[model samples]
Target chain A: MFAAQAFASLFSSPAKTSSPSLASDHPTGGQAAHHAKPLFFTTPHHLKLTYFPIRGLAEDIRLILEESGIAYESENISFHDWHEGGIKQQRAADNPFGQMPILYVNKGEFILSQSKAIIRFIARSTGLDGGDAYSAARCDQLAEGIADLRRQYATLAYDKEFAAKVGDFINKTLVNSFTTIERVYDQNKTRYLLSQDRVSYADIMLFELVDQILALGQDARSVVAKFDRIGEVYKSIAARPRIAAYLASSRRVVAINGASASVGAFKA
Target chain B: MSGDGKYHVHYFAGRGLGEIARIALSEAGVEFEDHRFESLPADLKATTKFGQVPLLVTPAGDRINQSTAILRFIGATHGLSGKTALENAEIDQVIEGVNDIRAKYRALPADAANEERIKFFSTVLPQWLGYFEAILKKTGSGFYVGSNVTIADLYVYVSFDSVINKTADAQPIDAFPLVKAHLEAIAARPRIAAWIAKRPVSQW
Candidate 1:
């Protein structure tokens, strides 16, 4: 079975983010808000990232753009607005998949969707992807491994009975997930996941995933802390100047459920 | 084929994920040891890095999983991915698009009611078919990304033949003329045609 294909539908829907209501409060109350023109067409030679305001699927992409020092326009679409008339009336006109994290490249002429696809595209162009075919494949494998772990975590995190079964989730699923990652670290024995001298996109992806898991709860954090290599990676990546600034800035959406929910889960 | 080390592909005896990589290898004229398992052997399963099949043991003795990653390796090694970053992105987009449709069908429950199945055929299937049709029209190259055949074309072709065409009571592809023609054109490639004729027939 193609697990990637089996789980692709899980990510097909637009990712939702937690944010203060923007329905009435238009922060940028100028021609920009009024016009509501397709951002892709007007923007040129700059990365245009469209996603929910919350740091869900787009968080890693945002970190990449910032770390690359690339000039990008980050549009945080309000969930309320999207449901009302935003996506159908305006956003859907340009996006083929009608999903968030759609990237506009090459002066807005080329539209790329699918978070992983977009991530790889940016990584390759920016040299965050490995130097050669083998290294690149290694990076891709690690990214896919992180994705698989996330998929397994989502099963428990998104469950309606999550609160009651949090212990089971951490013990049975979460620990195993971290162990799998730890094994990869052990095998590679490098500062980075793939043994690349510098940070690759996979390292960034792994850092984000570990950070999210730690954010779940004290139990989650304590368990994840046991993985020394993962802890090292998280610390190193978080200390990067741009990433550090982004984490400290208001741009980083506040944790929704304080360690109980997954990275993208909205507070109940 | 150029390397002295062995290239072994381990997957079940079926035309699933393994087929696309196999097609790419065949198209590139690379020699690899085809290791098909009637059912996954316990030892092999345990040894797999990701506990998954469609694992490509590179000549360098590194084990790789995930079909897309394997395809990328094959494409990069064999020069079928693309010439530039933009072209590779386009190719990735197409492969992901094809995966989206495949996922939708795979998501259907095993005990799905007749109405749900019918709904899939009538609505969902046509929607994706139309999207692929539009893609071919927009590209205007008869291939997915560029002027030449890439791994995306091979993937789209195998997916349509193995998954969409194999569905029970599947609709004909007559509506999407370009997609239909694209499938035929890929199948008629000399090496691909030879593989299709000689490769072991298995029920996916």
Candidate 2:
């Protein structure tokens, strides 16, 4: 089935110049000669990411690019750049959401102010889309869970009763979330959430959650130690070769808490 | 705020709907005009868009509305959206879910919303959390959508951290394993680590 799909994909796409048969037979004599390069090859996939100087949201796309092995230029501009230049201004004018993280592809820009949209796009290009509809939905559903977690945390983080609310949130909503996740881990026979094999973006996301919990202040470890499965998964992904290497590489990082208080502004 | 090139996001300084767009630019590595209003923007009342302040302006001076549309446009052109149709759809669905819950939270004021919020967080959220946990139960794989990272994961992590780490009246973190494990994974990312380290310090 996979082979048949691959063959179909090959034939469906325009012939490439690299194919000797097509190159020899066309001789500027047929439709093949008119359009030999693959449709995707017809245009370059250069991307320009527009956001604040901080990594408040774009990190996921960066991770996907690194994982996919696609080399795209990263144009780090400042807020001043947008005010000083009209292109950035016009780009946002075109934005329905009137936000940053507008991506310029081949000089033709497609804007997605939501962080998940951008990350998912990058993941798909990297062949990260999972096997079936259910699996894919599961991945999305997990992502939703993460979003919920962030919203809850954001509210509590800002409340004057930080200690009280944050602690309550951790004990109530967060704990329940983890327990439910633990149940999921058990259901999949202690493998991943979608299936028994193959890692997904959600897996990496889960790893991030655990790390954040552990590293959050001092008592975080104590809070996290309660969930054995979470701890186990954290150790597992942290140990993965690609992820480990990615983590080690300097390209994997940008500003984090420098704009932590800017959570309310994130459309990512 | 008076200039055509100026963009104003009216939300509180904390991470919210605007941060994703802000982060996307950082990842793609471009800068934009930004105005963070501690209080509502003084010119908000005069702005053309209906009372809200989270507005973006173009060089041509066009105004945009809705957060999802903006993110989609940014993701598509910048390669931040997923690689395939399925991945994109999945990301969309997850964002939809996030919206669903965020709407729930938005409906209520901080004090008045606590009870309803608690019920939704403890009950409704768990159901969704369970669904994700099932995905994580898959063998060997660590991600939500596919083997590689996706925006879905980032949003999820951001959302999770918002609840567990940021909120003062937020719920506990011990209840959901899928949620717990997933959070752990996202936090471990180096870029995310950098994000955490560089997060700004504010009174809120």
Candidate 3:
């Protein structure tokens, strides 16, 4: 079935190049030859990512762009000033939901809000989502898992008894969440989360989530070390050349609390 | 189903996360085993990738969890997903929007007082349903995205159905006529109607 779909796609028009196929292989000669195409057309639009001057939700999108080798402008809006009537009205006016982490594809022609939606859009365009339906489902599952973990962490961070019951939270919530993630990695037995050879958006999300957990002053290393496969996947994603460069560059904002919080209430 | 592989849907006996995929599979005219659990088996619970229900064991025996992922997989495989990226984006937006409302309802404490539920029914339900109504209005094609019945329609239908009819002490949803009409339209589909008639009943 997979082979038949591949064979059919080779002859299909470029317009039929769906998200799954785009994530797998380049368009065939027949499709490209029939159209006027540039040598480098991976990113078909002038991309712009708008968010706060923090790696809160936009960091995963940034990592995906870097991994896909797409050049995009990162416009970090100041959270404090934006709240204090600095572009607040304009920002709300521009976004349908009045939220940050908006992606302006083709400059300002197409606008997309919501971090997950933007991530999926960029992931599909850049071929980082997954190659097929099943793989894509796995990618979505892993990404949702990351979102669930982030939500739990946020709940703990805002809990009034958080400071007092930090140990209990770590043991019950954090460890259990990491265990589930570890099991996912172990079950897949892949270098990345879903794919054996390729790095999907889920890997990037997991890496960022783990990094945030570590940033929260929790002993993330110890928790993840128990799960060798997850640790390896984490190290592999961080060691990606572009990701490594981004991590070391000034472009990477330091983790902060309040407006710049990516991994709970923690200050870098 | 076109594929020769077997299908097994693992979920609790209730029509929770699994109903959307179940409806999609039925809509695709696929035959599969429905594994309903009153209480999750120890081994299955431990072995599930995410330690959750609504896990889909594909014909090839790949255990996939997460309701949205299952919905997307079935949609993509059975020609229920959107035909284009933009259409897919719009579909995803509706799915996410419905999920946002579901999340809000889930966040309410299980032991909450009647006043909270009343508030949710009065303010929150209408606000979210109004958004979906506006979406239906914008499309004007009677579908969530594009000109056909996609998985987004199934999701929204299942969500609205559960909230309006299935939930204990459910509230009336007559304010959003478009949404109610959309629900009626989907419910009238042959396969979906069959599933609705024969599926196990549960108090959600």
Candidate 4:
């Protein structure tokens, strides 16, 4: 395990350093050598991370790079950036769905939609996938579970008519949903799921869900408090080294400085 | 971009339909394009098969629709789909089961009666959950369908998350213990955890 971590770090250092001039560098020998040397490498040379400047949905993949210790530059384009008629025209020419977080690779470019797919791909490549394929599958399952929970939240919370339907969805579907997770946590004797051995992508995703619930001021902690196992699971993930740093970093949150936002406003 | 290494995916924000494919592509460490539209342009609108988004355009100009179809293709290329024919079938079954449930849950009309939600919650939801429970139980491991992560597992989680989170009511978290536990196991991953933290809390 230590050896693998060491090797990953060794490769990551060069990979990040090599891509310093990536935006203007194009696919030259330096970048090609870096991409080619990896035992395994993801496609998409240039990934235009499209998202509302706010942390709407691109955070998962961003966190993947942080956790994997992969260094990459983030192009935080806001709604304003795309509002320009020319920008939209450019996007029409370049993009298929006309979305953001698109990765541009060496051979050409591969379009990836959906956060889970992007996050899972990053996890598998970074050695962050659970120890084995079975565990990895488990990790993917958990992420999907979180996505389900979030969808429910969106329907009631985001919709304009949230008052009418919020209660049932929250009380029945959302709240009732936690029981399924709690049971698994209780049955498993390990500190983490998949035998409580090592941290996996699933753990990170779960923690985020719980945290988001709390951040919404919804008292998600009190809801899950009954399940001791679930609590422990999230605690373990929150304590991860890289994750802790990210949460502590100023750049960790959305970059809301006026310079960027003003530029974004004008661009839009 | 190099022709041999190019791939592309299309979808909107908010983790709708396209999330599963994104996870699969990332897990495989394969690079691809993530083409996005900002509020559905007219020209791109004409290109969409159904005028809905999430169309994957390959370098060879192969444009594909349906989020699952894109996932299966990427899974095939990355060796994440399955090792055998039988395994792939099982994976497909799991995906189908998940999709069936999602359709039922999402189709809940705006004017749906409490009984409708109740029926889904008690009868259909449990039955679907039980099916997954049985499959995972047989493996003596946490994953479903096959010995590895396939499009099935990804689809299930997304479906489960969507149903649980998108609903307009609240219920006890203990009702679906196995499903919840499965979710926790996946959430505990480092990369995934990071992904979650970085995502907007309200959106998740």
Docking class of 3: acceptable
True contacts kept of 2: 0.04
RMSD of 1: 12.3
lDDT of 1 by residue, A1-268 (tens): 0012222222211111132111113332111111111211222366688877666677778888777767787776667677685574575535555566678654465667777878887787666775466677878887888887765565567677777777887787778767777777877879886554578898999888887777668898889879898888889999989889888988777642223454455542
The model with the greatest DockQ is 3
Comparing 2 with 3 on DockQ, the higher-scoring candidate is 3
| Interface DockQ of candidate 1 | 0.24
Give iRMSD, candidate 2: 16.6
Local accuracy of candidate 2 as per-residue lDDT tens digits, B95-114: 65566555665665566356
Tens digit of lDDT per residue, candidate 2, span A1-268? Answer: 0012221232233222343232235443221232212322223467666666654456556555555555666656565566577656576433323345555554543334456666665544443545332244445445556655655665655466666666667677778777666655665574666555466776666776665455345465676788777677677766667667777877554443223342233222
Can you write out model 3's per-residue Cα lDDT over A28-146, one digit (the tens) per residue?
A: 21212212121112435588998877777788889998888888898977766668867767765344344678877666655666788778767765567765566677789989988
Give each prediction's root-mean-square deviation over alpha carbons. Answer: 12.3, 22.4, 6.5, 20.9
Best by TM-score: 3
Estimate the overall C-alpha local distance difference test score of candidate 2.
0.53
Q: How well is each residue in A1-268 modelled by candidate 4, as lDDT tens digits?
A: 0012222322333213333222224433121221212323433234345445544456666666677666555655556666764565565423322445443332223333335545655565555665333345445455555666765664445555655665566467656667666655555578776656566676666776666555433544457676677788777766778877887886465432222322111222
Q: What is the interface RMSD of each candidate, in Å?
A: 16.5, 16.6, 8.3, 17.3
Query: Which residue runs of candidate 1 sit more than 4 Å off their true CA positions?
Result: A1-44, A155-169, A255-268, B1-4, B112-118
Q: Which 10 consecutive positions of candidate 1 chain B have the poorest summed lDDT?
A: B77-86
| Docking class of predicted structure 4 | incorrect
